[model samples]
Target chain A: MKRLSEERTKLVFEKLTKYLGDNLKVLIDRPDGTYCFRERKDRVYYVSEKILSLASTVGSDHLVSLGTCFGKFTKSGKFRLHITALNYLAPHAQYKIWVKPSAEQQFLYGHHIAKSGLGRITENTPQYQGIVVFSMNDLPLGFGVTSKSTADCKHADPMSTICFHQADIGEYIRSEDTLL
Target chain B: MDVVNAILEKNVNSNKSISVHKDLELEIDEGTLLASDYNVFDKENLRSSQDTYLKNLTRDNVQVLINKIWMLQTERVDEAIVGILPKPVFVLPRARSVPKPKPLTKWQQFAKEKGITSKKKNKSKVTWDEELEKWIPKYGYKKAKADEQKEWLVEVNDPTKFTNGEDPFTASKTAKREKQAKNELQRLRNLAKAKNVKLPRVGIPSTEHFRDARQLAAATTIARASTASVGKFQSRLPKEKDAKDIASHVPGIKKKRKEAPLSVVQEKQRNKKLAESILRSKSTILHVDAPVPSTKSAKSSNSGGKKKSSKKEGKGAKKPKGGKGKRDLRSKVGGRKRR
Candidate 1:
């Protein structure tokens, strides 16, 4: 495993802050253990020192995976967070949207959330902001970027899309082979 | 009391290395020695009267130790009877690792295999000299020997060999030397055998002969790639048969693609610093690129640097603490007012 370069770290940090915001500090300066971001095979893993040191014993090429794959760098060199990071991101999400029961299935099927399905949205959530989508019962089902701001959602039509679909929990089954 | 009458109190801070102390000071030094007790006391048993309990325990233990020592067989030596101490009672914990068996020298290994026991040196430093008829050192200065002698002149039997008038003393001393050549040869042999550092071969010479295995491999690989046919048709060259060494002076080749270095520490600090700077810029759009922080603009408006710093602190105080806590309270009050 290797550390992210300054330029690469900047890209990863900027994307991470979009979802976690101020809670990003908890990941780096964790009390439970020292954690860091390591890049292996173009994928960044949020690994603790103990796990990383142990994993380092295995040859980089032969080692299949590392501790908690956070995201990967696209072919165009842009950083994208994967669905596997939902467990960590959900707890620290700055802006969140709770989906209605009727639309939870549709969201799981990888469809953009509509205004009618938006059970509740955090106030002042800016447009294009990264947000975690949860069910009305508080189960985090998926996450995506917002299409419209909180203020604009009130005047918009019920059928108009409010949240753009990026990834959902269903990917665990659909893309299980390629997740890591 | 007699020294106190003649003492000068003003000279207390004198810089002399040795100083005389009062009788009371010596007593205090000896009193602190009792703090290092070898016996253990059950703190709970002696909870009320520790000092008296410790005193009794120490006295009884010392008496038992003395009785044990006196029971041992005594020996008279140096005009006194002394008890022969037995093996220690307490086994202290080891403060260091087990001593490793030393690597055997060649002679020791040979002797062990041949079942040749070594003979101890004679304890006497002096040996009887036949020529001098007196005792002389066994090894050092002025040792008695029949062949090696300190004489004024040397008589050479072969006059033809000494026609060039060479120094016969050095020649005779070398001949008299015992195992000098054998010792040097064994030392070099041990050095080469330990790591198999190949000795320079006969017939040809090059600096590449001394290079390590890794460097030699890389150099050979580099040489093969640089040739006309790319070393495909080239026959395997004999190691002993020296060929033209290409890149013999070059140490190593530079890597084309450098991997991202492994320093989790630097990455952690760098990522944190970048994120903090980004977070700060998000709320307050300060001109980071602006030279000297627009205290220049403040300097134009204000007269002194002191006022500028105070004004900057005032600006900081005016900003809300956070986006959620205090801002939510302020927004709630504003919403109520608008209603």
Candidate 2:
């Protein structure tokens, strides 16, 4: 396989830095033909072999996939986090909602979670902002959009809906399987 | 002379006509004609006449007399023609006529009578206030309220609410960062909770043990050696070669071979042949005119000359060999060039 050119590597780095952060370190291996990333704290993450191979099929206009989650690098050089990317970003992310097992199933099935099923909601989460959803076991379920403000969520009824699920593994699988 | 006397006798009988001739004779006798004055006369002989009576009659008075006689003859002819010919008939020009305007439609007529210009009214315009940092309606309270409500509805899903000045990508980045920070805090809290609470361990052990056939054989051999002999069966016995040799016999061993160096003469000859071959290949590909390098001195001299000539040429013009010009000619002749 041909290795990425210096210009392409620089473009990828710029995009990743904008989306991920300024502290991200991207390394390209010419011999092995692999891409790897390290955060500010020196935690290294490798681009999945599957995604690396998929890079060949991607068009010139397509965004680069950074990690296993295939978090896309937009044309504007910002990273749009996919649900799979949450596994890598969960540790460093700010707001998270721990859902009940039932709610987790519902969330993966592409249904929004109600306030009652939420085990915990982080403080100061703004309304309509992007958020990460996790299961009871601490596995990142998916990403979601907050439907209510932090203050509103506090005073609202227990059954009131909190977040609208954005992306999940179940949705990805459904999209991939033609038989469905 | 008889004709002249007849004309004079006829003029004397008409006293009114004779009165005009008498006035002409009086006007002519007032001026004394000169020789220079004769130049103004149309007839050459009349201008050079020495008779004083004719001299007193200037060219102007003679012309007036001729005009009066011509006018009298023309007037008599016109009068006789008018008596015989029929009168001409004239037609007067008529004024242009215009068509009446079409009757207006019922709605148009009603609108005209009511003095209503248009059916729809001008909507209230809204402008952004720099001081207040919000959009304000130019009209009344109702319009302002409506604008506010519309703004509120749009603001709900507005991604730029928090990141107004930033681009869409940067705005999304800020949102993602905010989300990540929240998740990290929650994770830390969960980690604390797990530390404080005593949770039961679940699932199978992470590490696994496997027994290989070779490992089993080696273990048995080691056990038998320990039981049978203390110092007899060593890993590397004195009778055996090194472990590498044993590994080589096992299979998949790559042994490194040392290459032998060529003699000076052979090396020189080989290098010369290689260089000649390279030059030949290059000449074939590029169609260079220079001969192949058989000897070092000849090659060096040729290259030096070529460099000097190339420098003199600077950037040479490209020759269109086997190109459009040649192809067009070959096509016209219906013949292909040999490769």
Task: Write candidate 1's Cα lDDT for B188-223 as tens digits.
Answer: 867775666776566653665746655566556666
- Give the DockQ of candidate 2: 0.01
Among incorrect, acceptable, medium and high, the docking class of model 2 is incorrect
Supply the TM-score of chain A against the true chain A for every candidate structure: 0.96, 0.58
Cα lDDT tens digits for candidate 2, A17-99: 22223123222222344344322111122454556456647763463333453343444533334455555445545567889
Error of 2 at B174 (Å): 77
**iRMS for model 2?**
32.1
What ranges in model 1 sit over 4 Å off? Answer: B1-262, B284-339
Model 1 chain B scores worst on lDDT over the 10 consecutive residues at B313-322
Instruction: Compose the digit string of candidate 2's lDDT tens values, residues B33-142.
Output: 11123233336556566564464454445555444444432323745622222232333254766656655544556789999787558754777766556677777666
Q: Pick the candidate with the highest TM-score.
A: 1
TM-scores vs. true structure, each candidate: 0.40, 0.25
